[model samples]
Target: MQAILQSSDTELDIVRALRENCERPFEDAHAMPPAVYTSEAFLALERRDVFRTEWLCVGRASALANCGDYLSAQIDDQPVFVLRDASGALRAFSNVCLHRMSVLLEGRGNVRRIVCPYHAWNYTLDGSLAAAPLMDRQPGFCKEQYKLPAVRCETWQGWIYVTLNEHAPAVESHLSELSKLIEPYGMGDYVETFHEEHVWDTNWKILAENFMESYHLPMLHRATVGPHSRLEEMECPPGSPAFNYHWITKEASLPIGNAHPTNTRLEGHWRRTTALLAIYPTHLVTLTPGYFWYLILQPQGVGRVHIRFGGGLAPEFVDDPQAAGYMATLKTLLDEVNAEDRRGVEAVFRGVHAPLAKPGHLSPLERPNYDFARYLAGRLGAT
Candidate 1:
């Protein structure tokens, strides 16, 4: 096993400084300036130095379960496509036609050839230039020179990751600690059950930081998550690898006693061993007995984020299509909880924009969010 990279004394000092500066009283949460939420300049910098260089989860491997299956998506404004070719090898591409710079596929489907709509230029599922409308008419047209541009794609624990840079290192090299962190739960065996897209009117970082801490659950999601999950019971395992942390919370268990008076069938469903794990940048994997939810947050712009929530169920449940309905019901319940969070975050965004705001202190209970912010600041070359 490779040795985990230890944080140097300088890194520890930085952490201490961040903890001291960011952690303040509850009233200070609103003190954080609006720039963190609304600065276009900061967003552009993050896109170039942070998102561009990081390994980002784009889709799930199961999305391409059969031969010739493919999905097209945009990662941080860069167009990319994921496909399982005829030979069953998963591949990713720039999703742009080599001929005239047009997108080859708009959505997901099974295709023997990816034909560009702007022209009849077609490429094989493997991204080879298979056909062109009238290449012979163009004297200098060369099939080899016009093949689709390929991107670096890899799969880990059933999730698909793509990087825009051709020469970027392998995904494993960057996700040094992720494998061990997820191994305990047998993540590879879980099946996806629910998936949805939500638009958040805040920076992707804000959403990420919000998730790293359970401090807000009591206030923001009092009805759903608060009664069951408590900050005191939330466990942040020590000696966790940098940029990634492992946590196990018992509060995720369903409510009991008086809390159960108005409990519905859904409460019994959610009570089943709910586990949450987040990989850096924008992937959050949460598991429960009834379903597995994988969230991928894509930054659309400075003030907008596209959130994809994919749910996977146990294989036994998936064998019967009817079971998917149960999963859908769970998703609906979650949608309500998420809607509450969305409104709260939007309110925070508005408050941060006020001229009275400043960088706030971090609470000891909010160590996870503070750590995450420090990680982001380090990656974006911020102090």
Candidate 2:
């Protein structure tokens, strides 16, 4: 472990800064240093120590409802894809072609076969090499011998997670406590009505930390959701090993932001409460009574992040006569919120590059950010 994390001096400096942050008391803890986000060496360390070893969420399983629908993604440089097979079971595998190493798929869509563009070689929905054109003419080139490598794909409460580490703990087992706490929201049943992919100019950790804290909601989002976010109404308890969370009661601009009238699981003020969850490295979910939305982050080097953004109505709101209206309102609000966040996170990325840039002290509202910093440090720290 030390050899992996301590491979380079620059990375060692960044990890030391992170450990220093973790060593402080709650009131005294500061933000992690800028190098954690800007250092290529440190990003390389995370590529090995964090992304390769964690259960990274791709998107919601609801987005891949039909057979052959697949989501393509990467961990470090290893390209992978996850799809719902013809048998209706979800599976993931290397996206690279076995013939000439072309990526079998690009982006998400329904397909009859995973065809390589470089060559005509194709694969079944289950990742079996279905056809390798003209390969039969070659000696001893069995199609079975060229099947795409399998990867571990797991569904945790409707979210699709894939990991390169076969020895990693089960997704369900890792988030069991979080499941119990968020059970009343019926998160697994919310069908995703919208899914999108975008690349943003910001460090992935900066974006992850942005989603982890609501301290800036009243100011950064003042033109949008800021007015509804009252700091006093928020709750940030100590985070657990696998994740961190915070909650706030919202006076919604969209009715769907609150619990639907048909919702019975939530009573009183619980209907207007929203739970913000940071599941380990990169899965951030805003689970509300009437709807839910999430961001699955993937780092593109040290300065850019590839984001899978999506959301949908809760089970109660999905069946309402006004479901279309709710979906429209939710999408509009999300677009606005994302625009605001994009501006904010991108600015922070620029600021981090300044010569005097350094992490500052944290507020109580930034507890989740503190926890997230520690999570990053813990992952890249030496044994």
Highest lDDT model number: 2
Best by TM-score: 2
Q: Model 2: what TM-score?
A: 0.96
Summing lDDT over every window of 10 consecutive residues in candidate 2, give the lowest-scoring window.
1-10
Any runs in candidate 2 off by more than 4 Å, and if so which?
1-7
- Summarize candidate 1's per-residue lDDT along 217-298 as a digit string, tens digits: 8888887767666566656542233444534434333222111222233243233345566677788766554457766888
Consecutive 10-residue window with the lowest summed lDDT within model 1 = 254-263
Candidate 2 lDDT over residue span 271-302, tens digit each: 88899999988999999888888999989878
How far is 221's C-alpha from truth in model 1 (Å)?
A: 1.4
RMSD of 2: 2.4
In candidate 2, position 298 carries an lDDT of 89
What TM-score, to 2 decimals, does candidate 1 have?
Answer: 0.81
